[model samples]
Target: MGSLWSQFSTPNPMFTEDDVAPQDSKVFRITGGYSGIGFELAKMLYRKKGRVYIAGRSDQKGQQGIKDIQHSASAEAFKPKEAKLHVLWNNVGVCQPPVGSASKQVIELQLATNCLGPFLFIRYQLLDHAH
Candidate 1:
C-alpha cells in the first residue's frame, strides 16, 4: 500500500523550518523536549518567535532547555498563565523496558509515559490553556 511504502521510503521532508511563518504570539508546549528531536523542534519553533515551553520530569533539565532555546533564539520568556496554547506536543515516550518495570506510580512504565501521562497533561493542563 502507498502508506506502507511511504513508511520505508527515504525520508523527504515536505515541510521544514523554512516553511514556518513568524509565530509572533503563538504558544507551544512540548514534553520530553529537553533533548533529542523534541529539543530541535522547540528550537525551530522558538526561532520563529513562538513562545515555547518544555515540560519534563526534571525541573533542572527543563530550565536548561528553556535557557538554551532563549539563547539560541534570542527571545525573552513569556508568562504561562497569560499565553493560550496554540499547540501541545506529547513528545515524551519510552520504549521496551525490563519486563517488570513500572513507573513511580506503579503503572506500567511504557503505558504511563506514552499514554497516561499525556492524557493527564491534556486533560488537566491543556484544557486550561487551549484557545
Candidate 2:
C-alpha cells in the first residue's frame, strides 16, 4: 500500500543535475544512450564537461545522439581511447522479445541484452583499466 501511494505522491528529488559537480575530466559511457533516459543523462553529463560516450547496437542512432549532444552542449569531441572510464552506465535493455529469439551466442535475446551484455562490458572495462 505504501509503495502504491508513493507512486502517486509528488516527492522532490533528493539529487538532481544541479547538485552534480563539474566533470571536466571525468569519463562516462552509457549504453542505450542513443535515446530516452540514457540520452538525457548523456546530455547532462556532457553539459557538465564530462567526456561522454554513447553506445548502442545501432551505429546510426549512436552517431545521431552524439551529434545532438554536441550541438546542444556546443562541446568538442575528445578521443575516448585516451581516458579510462570514470563511470559506466549499463542502461541497455530489452523486454519481451519473441520466443526462441537468440543472440549471436545463442542466449535468449532479452537475457543477452539485459544481463550478459552488461556483465561482459564491466569485466572488459575492469580488466582493461587494471594496472
Candidate 3:
C-alpha cells in the first residue's frame, strides 16, 4: 500500500492562466459534475465558452447542478444563449456502489458505472457527434 501520509502532504500541481486556458469550441461532459471538483471544472470550462454537459446518475440532481453551474458561469457580464441538455440519456446505465462491504452486485455495478458505461457512451454517442 502507498503511504497515506504522503498522499495527503503532496502539493497540488501548480498552474497558470495559460495552463488553465480553454478553447471556446470544445464540448465538455463532466461525470458527477453537479458538485465538488466536477462543478468547479465545469464552471471554468463554461466560463470560457465551452459547452458543458453534466453527467451523473440522478436526473433531478444533474439538472439542478447544470442550472447552478450555468447561472454561476454567466455572472461575469456574459449570458448563456441556451440551457444545455439533450445529450445526457444513454443506452446503458451505470451504478455507483457503496464503498466497503462489497457484494458481487455492488462490484459489478461499480465496474459498469466507473468504467464500462463511459466507454460505451464515448464510443457511440460522442464519436457520432464528433464527425
Predicted structure with the largest TM-score when compared to the true one: 1
Give the CA lDDT, 0 to 100, for residue 103 in model 2: 97
Candidate 2 Cα errors over 4 Å, as ranges: 1-9, 96-101, 122-131
lDDT of 2: 0.86
For candidate 3, the per-residue lDDT at 102 reads 42
Tens-place lDDT per residue, model 1, 6-113, is 888867889989999999888888999999899999999889888888888899998898888888887666674644678889899988988989999999999999
At residue 39, candidate 1 shows an lDDT of: 98
Judge candidate 1 at residue 16 and give its lDDT.
85
Clashing pairs in 2: none
**Ten consecutive residues with minimal summed lDDT in candidate 2?**
74-83
Per-residue lDDT tens digits for candidate 2, residues 32-131, read: 9889999999999999998888877799998899888888996668575744778889888888989999999999999999999998877885565775
User: What CA root-mean-square deviation does each model show from the true structure?
Assistant: 3.5, 2.8, 6.7
Model 3 C-alpha lDDT per residue in residues 38-113, reported as the tens digit of each score: 7777777778777777767689988888788768766333234433333343323335545553435554666666
Better of 1 and 3 by TM-score: 1
lDDT of 1 at 71: 84
- In model 3, the clashing pairs are none
